[model samples]
Target: MQENQIDHLFQQGFSLHQQGRLEEAQVIYESILKLQASHFNALQLLGVIFLEKKQFIHSINLITKALQIQDNQAPCYYNLGSAQQGLQQYEEAIARYDKAVAINQEFAKAHHDRGVALQELQRLEEAITSYENAIAIQGSYPEASWNLSLCQLQVGNFHAGWRGYEWRWKNSEISKTAGLRNLKQKLWLGAESLQGKTILLHAEQGFGDTIQFCRFTRLVSQLGAKVILEVQPSLVSLLQNLEGVSKVIARGDPIPECDYQCPLMSLPLALNTDLNNIPGVPKKFITCC
Candidate 1:
């Protein structure tokens, strides 16, 4: 096929993708590969399409081919890294992300993805730094901020982490509800301590996060304040036994007056959590209260 014909096919594929005709786009991209087997753009885009289709291995193969043909293409490495991540080949994904970052230090997506791979590998501290780098490089990606916060929590840098985690409210999946206080409250920033006041911790994230962070109520309450826990139904029974909790309520319900309210994920930020001071539960998070 002529160069122009191949380019036209590529453009058509891209248009289809933009129109959300992913299967049609993939077919065209694959056809471009048949005409020009080493076509860099075709392979790279097809790799991305495969990734979207959840065909991780195929995406990896296509992206690796594209990378070989165009070693300098940052997007190729990013897509390759993503494909590797989808396949749970975290080390390899991190390596690809490293290459992407090295090629373009300002590549915010690369740093974000690398942090994700590091997090998956349990390299918590390093992951947090990578996430911070991503935020520094590009402040627009909400997931980067949210993931960084979780990483900080994992490493016990609670204060910074919880603030980062609050980006969850911006996520499409997170249900937004106006708390007693404004959603813009600084509870995660620990701008004010809970000393001599009521602190309401509204549940955020999954059930497991509520179970894990409920332990912080004991410390918060012990500091001479009441700790109100806004929890999910599944976790309420388990959380009632956690020390320091004065009350538990379901989400979206109006609660009693409190001096401060924070998301459950923000406990780390409020307590300045770190490896030495993670909010952990020593006893059963469930059972006799």
Candidate 2:
């Protein structure tokens, strides 16, 4: 194909990609490669489409080919990092993200993703620094802030972690997946007086988070609040017997009217939990069936 024809096909493929028609875009990119084996855009974007499709190895191969054709493209390294991350090759992903950042100092997303890779590798301090760098580059980056919170929590920096944890609400993906309650009631974040009032403690994360934090329900009740706990359906039977909980409602059930609300994960922060004084697991909370 002539140069103009290749550019036209590339534009068409990119347009399809922007429309999220990955399969069609992949075909067009592949056609471009058939005419020009070393076509940089075709290889790079096809690799990205494969990465989106979860074809990690193919994604890596194509992206590597793109890098060979043009080593200076920062996005190529970033996409290569993503493919490595998909395969759980954290160290490789970090190296690729590092290269991306080295190529473009303003690459905030590369720094953010490098932090994710570092966190996966259990390098919490380094991950925190990486997240901070990303935040410094892009102050309004919700994902980096949210991840920095996790790294802080992992290292037992409760004050900063929980404070930053609130950024999860700013992340559209997390907010969508975790399904934040849209109640107009105020969120009780420890300082609120629960005296003579009903408090709704809803589970906003996975089962493990609910199990771990349900211990706070008793503490809430101890403060003279009517504690209504909402948990996943699978845990309703187990938690129904929990002491101090006035009512245990399964998720999806209509939540009773409450004066305040809080996500279960935030209970620790609300209760002023720390590494040394973290609440012990309730003896009967976990038992074999």
Candidate 3:
């Protein structure tokens, strides 16, 4: 095919990709490679499409081909890192992310993703640094801030962690998953006095988190507030035994009238929790029958 014809096809494919038509874009990219085997853009973009499709091996191969044609591009390394991450090759992913950052020091996403891989490897301190670098580069990066908070929390740095944890509400994925986006009620972020107020404390993440943080219910009550604990149906019976909860309601049930609301995970921040004074039950909260 003529060079102009190849360029036209590439443009068409890129347009399709921008419109979220991955399959069509892949077909066009494949067609471009058939006409010009070393087409760098086609190889790189097809690799990205494969990555999105979760075909990690195919993504690696195509992206490697693109690198052979043009090895200096930061995006190629980033895509390679993503493919490696998909295959659970976290070490390899971190190396690739490192290369991407080395090539382009302004690659904030590369730093953030490297932090994720490090966290997966249980290198919490290194992961925190990586996340902090990303945040320093892009102050408004919610994902990086959230991950940084998680690493800090894992390392028992509750003070900095809970402050960073506030970014979770700004992340679209977390907000959507927690179903907090549509709620019009104000989030009680420990700034308000709970005295004489009916506070709705809702479950946010998983059963483990709910179980771990439910100890805060008694603290809220001690502050002279009525607590309505909304939790997963599976935990409703168990949580009923928890003290200071005025009522235990299952998730998806209609919430009663309340003066304020907070997510379970946010309880640590609300109560000014620290590692030395972390909340705990006197005994096991649950006893298996």
Best by TM-score: 3
Q: All candidates' lDDT scores? A: 0.78, 0.90, 0.90
lDDT by residue (tens digit), candidate 2, 171-223: 99988767677887799898978889999999987888888889878888989
- What overall lDDT, based on C-alpha atoms, would model 3 receive against the true structure? 0.90
Q: Judged by TM-score relative to the true structure, which candidate is superior, 1 or 2?
A: 2
Say which prediction, candidate 1 or candidate 3, comes out ahead on TM-score.
Answer: 3
User: Taking the tens digit of each residue's C-alpha lDDT, what string does model 1 give over 1-289?
Assistant: 7899888889999999989899999999888888889998888888888899999999988888888887898888888889888889999999989998899999998999999999998898788789889989887778888787777666655556666666776655543531223544345346666678887788766677677767777777877778888888777777776777888887776777877777765666666665555455344342221
Candidate 1 clashing pairs, residues 3+ apart or interchain: 156-273, 156-274, 158-268, 158-269, 158-273, 159-269
Assess candidate 2 and give its TM-score to the true structure: 0.89
Q: Name model 3 segments beyond 4 Å from true.
A: 181-185, 252-254, 281-289
Clashing pairs in 2: none
